[model samples]
Every structure is written in C-alpha cells, then in structure tokens.
Target: MLGRKLNDRYEIQALVGEGATAAVYRGLDLRLQRTVGIKLLLPYVDSTTRQRFQREAFSAAQLNHPNIMGIYDVGEEKDQNFLIVEYVEGEPLYSFIPSPPQVVAEYGRQICLALDYAHQKNVIHRDIKPANIHITPSGQVKIMDFGLAITPDSKRLTAMGRIIGTPAYLSPEQAQGLKLDYRTDLYSLGIVLYELATGVLPFDADDIGVLLLQQVKKTPKPPSELAPEIPPALEAVILKALEKEPQNRFTTAGEMAAALQIVLDGGADTRTTIQPAAAEPESAPLSAPAEAPHTGPIRVVLADDHRILRTSLAMFLDVNDDINVVGEADNGDQALEVVRDQQPDVLLLDLNMPGLGGLDILPQLRSNWPDVKVLVLTGRDEDVYIMRALRAGAHGYVLKTIGEDALVQAVRDVAQGNLVLGHGVAERVVQGFVGRAEVTSNVLTTLEHAILTGIAAGQTNDEIAQRLKLDPQIVGEELIELLDRMGTASRTEAALIALRRGWVALEDLHNIS
Candidate 1:
C-alpha cells in the first residue's frame, strides 16, 4: 500500500510491517501534517482473521493509556478495512538486544510498567513479544500491536486447536491448550527476558511440537545457572514468574514491580545476603598456599531437569581450564542436597525443575550459605522475570542461547562479586521505569480544558478566538502551550491526553461555567 492515498487524506509513505492478517504502513496525514500508522486488513484473510482485527481495534480504542499505542480511527472504504494509529518512530525491543546491560535493564522496567497499566485496564496483551514493544528515540517504551490482545469480557479469538503466539514464548498453559489469563502474558514475557539476558532461547528445538512439549512438560534452567553473576534474589524472581501455575506466579504486574524496586533499592532483604549454610566451609585461609598454588579446579554443581541439556552444559563447563563438574541434580530438591554436601563455587539452576523449582531453593541456599553466588539459566526471559529474579537475589541471568565464552565469563564475574545480566535483560528493566514516566505524563492541564471545551461546543479554534474576541494566533499559541505544559510533545499526544482525561467531553464540555 506504500505510495497509495486513502480517502485523499492519509498518504501511505512506506510499508512498516506485514503480519498474518494485516499490513502496517507509515502514512502522512495531509490535513494534520503529521505521520500516522495505518493497519490495513489483508484482502484474502479468512472471516476469523477479519473478526480478530476488528475486535482488536475496538478493544484497543477503549484504552487511553500513555504506555499503549493510541488508536485514532477505524474505518472501511472501497472493500478495505483499516485502523489508524499513532506512528511511533522507534525500534522494537528485539532490535535493542545485544546493546548493553544497563540499557536492557532500563528497557525491561518500562515494559513491566506498561504491562501493569494494561492489566489494570482489564487488557491482556496476548502477544507481549519484543516485536510488539516499541522503543522511541527519546528512550520511551510503548507497547503496540494489540491485534492479539484479550479483553476481559471478550470471547477467545483463536479456534480450539490453533496457537496464537511464537512457540518459544508460549506460556505453559498456552502450550497445554488450557484457559489463559494475565499470567499467560507474564510467562511469554519471561521468555523475552530470558532472551534479552542470554541472547538465547531457554528451550531450543528443531520442531514446534518439541518446543511446545518442553514448555508444557519440562522445566527450564535458571538464569543464574547460565549467567552466574545474576544475584540469587533476581533468580528467585525469574523462576517465580515462570511458575506453571498462575496462582504460583505474581498475581499482578504492580506487585512484581514493587518486588523489583525492593531489590534495586538495596533493601536489607536483598537476595545477595542469603544466610550461610549451617556447615559453613572453614573460611578460606586469607592466603592460600602461595607455593603449592590452588591444586584442583573450581568445582560447580549443575542442576536442571532436562537430562540431555543439563549433561551437555555440564560437559561443556568441565572442559574449561579452571572449572570442574562436581555433581548434578535433576530437580530443586536434589540441588539443595547436592549443595549441602558439595558446596561448589557455582550452582546452575533451572526454573521449572520438579518438586520445588530453582527459585524455591535460592533462599534455602542463602539461609545455608550466604556467600555462594547463584546464576540463573533459563529460557524464560521477560521484564517481570528479570525483575523478580533480581529481587530474589540471582547473581546474573543467562539464556541458554549465550555463547560459551559469555557463560564462562558470567561465572567468573559472579565469583568476583559483580552482577551480570544477559544481552537484553538490563535494557528491559530500565525501559520499565521509562514507561512509568510516560504513564505519568498522561495527566491533564488547565488550558487543555479550555481548548477541549471550545472544540466540544462545535467551535473551531478561529471561531472560538472570534467569539472570545482573541487573536487566532493567540488561541493557537495557547493550544500549543497547553500541549507543552501537559507534557505532550505533539498534537496527537495532546489529543490523546485530552480524550483520556475526559477534558474533551463533546457534549458535557459546553456545560462548563
């Protein structure tokens, strides 16, 4: 649709994205002199796809949130249906990975904030993957593409046997073909977080079926196990978010944010200060035998439920010059027992192990031995998971997809009292905070009330200026000033804020005294 004009108003400038049911275009609004995004339904789409697209537009239009991409107009013309939305000039979260740790943490935080707001609005972004998350040049994170969203009162869009999201990010409940809720989105986000940290999928498989099976029936390694520098507290949070049972996961995104805040604030309960094991190793002599040098290699206890993957990782680490595999466990319970006996420098944990997942064992390990640095190794990477893991005291988060060099470096970093995060984990956390700022910007201003009232009374800015016997330039200047004062950098932003704050009450604004 690029180069095409719709209704002689919006001129399509370029094709931005193409999806299963629709295509997105960057279009110029001639009258408004601004760019906007237009989502046009594909001509050959099935009835179901059309229905879903329409439903998405309707549901999304109801939400007036700063963190959410705004829907401006929905209409059909010449046998084509389309939805007009705010055009965000930014890269997707997926594109920002591999940048830097602090960037990833910041971005992740913004995502969490956006999710929290959407949840409060009774909206579940069924597809919370990186592609749907936009990061503006100013470092604002806005969640877009609600095409697959599930509204609180709406019926399911997909048919009985069809899957909705990417295989790698599907929640266990989604993989199992069961009913879903807000927690399902959290699970997908967990995968995103994992990828951000480690730049790898938790469960890498050749086939979709295998990936789905793993998601539904198998446990994933903890983020810390893969990247040792992740604090134990952070690992606990990640594992908790990946919980198969919704009830076991955080009930609300706000609670997850609060927990993360506690971790970042260096509260006394920080995961790093876990109590030492009862049989603390005789403190290492401050000076090891200088001449005899440390004899054996650094020992590590590898724990994960997937035998093949666990064994593979263990073998890989053992090949390193300074590392030796001391023991392995298939579940959290076994991991604890092994740690009690082995007391290795590192513990590789999986989030989904049987009988108390890795997170459940973190506090136990801390209570028993506070000094042991725990790294999480998992496929679940989402802002929520990253925050939770950090709060729970994980030393670092590494995805299975990370290279051997980075994985090994993570272990060394943790052992040296440094915090480590996988490729995109840190950015997401920071973005979550940015998103909070954007949400706060949605608040209203006094001048906005006057402009909205005038518009509501069917008076153009020029006409209103005439009625008030004021210069049109002054009125327009006032409107611009109002937008600036309200923290809306653009006209669209001002309009959206006004609409959301109920300042533009078409009927009621005229009643203003």
Candidate 2:
C-alpha cells in the first residue's frame, strides 16, 4: 500500500502490523508533514467488529498524555474505518529489556505515568504487552493500541463467546470472563514488566488451557529468587501489583508510579549488611587524594543454570567501565553460597534453576542478607512470576532479552538502592489487586458457579460438560452469562471469587481430567 494516498492526504509507507480486526500502516500525513500510524478495519468485518473498532478509537481519543500515543483523527473512506495515530520512531519497549537498573526504572516510571493518566480518563488498556509499548530514540515510552480497551461506561460489543485480548498477558478476571476496570490493564502491564525484566513468562505450559489454569490457580516465583541482585523494595512493589486480589494491588496507576519514583529516589529502605558492635579505634592521619577518584564500579554477580550464560555475563561485565562482575553461580543454591562468600553488590539470577529454584531461595536470601540488592535476569514475564519475585524481595527486574547497556545500567541503579523494574512489571502489580477486587465483588453467575465447582474439582470445561451431558459451547455461554450477571469482567475473577467462597476447591480443579 506504500505510496498510495487515501482520502487525498495520507500516503501509505509500509505495513506495520495486521490483526483479525484491522491492519496498521505506517503513513505520511501530507497535510501535517509528519509520519503517522493508521489502523484500518478490515472492509468485511461485521457490525460488531466495527463497533469495537470505533470504541477503541473513541477510547484512545479521550486520552491525552506524553506517554500515550495521540490519536490525530478517526475516519472512514470507501467503507473502511481507520484511525490516525502519532507515529513512534523507536523500537518497542520489549526490544530494550534487561536494561541497566536506571534505564529500567526510567522506563517503568514513564509507563506508570501513562497508565495513571489513562486511568484517570476512565480508559483501561486491556492489551498491555511489549508489542503495544513503543520507546522513542530519546527514551520516552508511549503506550499504544487501545483496540481492546474498555471503559466503565462503555457497552460490551462482542458476544460472550469471544475472548478479547492476548491470553498470555491476561489477568485472572479476564481469563474467567469477568467485568474489568483499570486494574485489568495493570495486571497485563505486570506481566509485561516481568517479561521485560526476566525474559521468561511466569507461567508456561504446552497448551493455552493449561496456561490459563496456572494463571488462575498458581502463585508466581519471586523476582529476587531469579535475580539475587534485585532490591527488596522493588520486589515488594512488584508483588503488591501482582496480588491475585485487586484489593491487594495499588489502587491507582498514579500510586504505582509514585512507588516507582520513590524507588528511583533512593527511598527504598532495604536492609544491607548487619553491623556488629566494636570498640572505637584511634583515627588515622588523613592522606591526600591519589588523583580525582572516579565513582566506584557497580558490583554484580551472575547466577543461572547454564555455565555459558555465567561466562558470557562475566566477559560482558569486564568490558564495561562502570560495572564489575564479582561472582558467578550455576543455580539458586550456588547463588546463595556465592552471596554468602562474596556479597556482591548485585545478583543476576535465573528463575528455573536446578537444586533450589530461584523462587525458593528468594525468602532465604532476603532474610539472610537484606542489604544485598538483586536483579532478576530470567526468561519468564508472567504476572504470577512477577508477583512472586516482588514478594521475595527483588529490587530490580530485567529480562534476558535486554541489551548489554540496559543490563549494566539496571545493575548499577539497583546496587545504588534504586528500585528498578522493567517496562510492564509495575503496572501489572498494581492492576492485579484492583482488578481482582472488581471481578470478585461485581460478577458471578450460576453457570460460572458450576464451572467453578468443576474447576475446584480439577475438571476441564469439556469434562464438566460431559458429566452434565451439555455442549461445551453451552457451558461456555452459561458461564459467560453467569459472569455478566455477577457484574465481573473476566472469567478468572469469577473463579477466584468462587474459590474464595469455597464454591470450588483448588485441588479438585487442578486434578480435573
């Protein structure tokens, strides 16, 4: 479509991406002499799809913030609806992971600011993922794609049968077909942050069903367990955001942003070395400066199950002037040993390590050495994992996918007692709690209750339907109807409420055939 002018103004340059509902194009606005992104709905989309598209455009148009991509116009030409948005020139935030602690903190701060602004406008970005977050050359972060966004007052366009956003980043309430609010977006953002910091998803399975089950039932491993160098304060912030119950998460995006800023301002009061009392000694004579001394190098330790990763990290740190790799370990147990012996300024840990898993060691490390900072460097970026890491006392979280510079910077910032988090983690932690609250109190249905019982008994929907001799679609529809009646936005929330009310049992549901 490049060079093709639409509506006598926009000159299509290239295809940026495509989805089931619409196609996004890179285009030049001849009138404004600036590049813009155009999202055009597929010409043949049904009325429902059209309505959703229009809603997305309208929701985005209501938001005006530096961290959010601006909507210039929404229009239709030749029966195709399209929206023009500010073109971000840089790469996605996902591409810049494992950034230095400072960079991670900065990115997180910006994302929180955007979220706060959007939430204040009563818009919830249901799709909060790396693909939707753009980072400009100047390091400014912009959130895009309100295509799956939902407003409190907005009408539900899709039928109960359809799932709205990506499953991997979905909140428990969303997965369960419950009503949503700003917290839903926060939960998704938490997953993004986890992924950005650790390069891994918190929950992984061979299939989507299993993944969703884990999302609703299992708890995440702490970030500190994965990366020992992360600070406890930072980890606390992440855990708070990832709380399975919305009431446990930050109440607003602004609150989350404020927490991140506090971390960045060195307000993280994490425990450091335990000092023992000693007798005062006579003061030594002062000496002149050998030369104007430079700041001390940022100390770090590398911990992973792979030997090659440790070696590579060590080699990489050797070349950086401000960073120094002081130790290496092959697993969580080994990491603990190294921490005890070397007490490095930062620890880069892996989540799925042998012997003691990263999550298993987080509490131990935090309890034993509160002063040492941890930076989780892993492959998982799920809300569960992000929450677990935060709970375990990680100070910073960066994914393996991050570049060398960002990783180096993250280490430095965490070592300096700053709470640095990758792009999506902070938002997720805050949203997790709020969304949970909304889903639990607002939505519930009879079919959902039946499914919850089946889930509690470890039964899949198919099995539940089979036991009742009902069609899977019927069961799904009934569940959706129940959720709607309960006023919850997502299925995950409905299940959680059911579980809490003893309407379902986790063991039963987990063991369902």
Steric overlap count per candidate? 87, 85
Deviation from native of the Cα of residue 41 in model 2, angstroms: 1.7
Residue 199 lDDT, candidate 1, scale 0-100? 66
> Model 2, range 360-432, lDDT digits (tens) per residue?
7888988998877878888776555665676578776667777665566566556655455665554454444
The CA-based lDDT of model 2 is what?
Answer: 0.68
lDDT of each: 0.66, 0.68
**Candidate 2: residue 46 lDDT (0-100):** 52
Residue-wise C-alpha lDDT for candidate 1, range 1-513, written one tens digit per residue: 777888888888876555434667778889999878888876645566678888778768878776678888888879899888887765566655543333444555567777888888788888777767766656677777776788656777652223556667888776655677888887777777766665666776633344565776567798766776555655565677778788988888777766555545543322221221122222110111112222235678888999999888888888876678899999988998898899887787777677778766777787787666688888866444444455567766777777776677566545544456666654444443233223345433333456656655556788767765544655676666565556766666665656667667645554643
Point to the candidate with the largest TM-score.
Answer: 2
Q: Which ten residues in a row have the lowest lDDT in candidate 2?
A: 282-291
TM-score, per-candidate, Cα-based? 0.50, 0.53
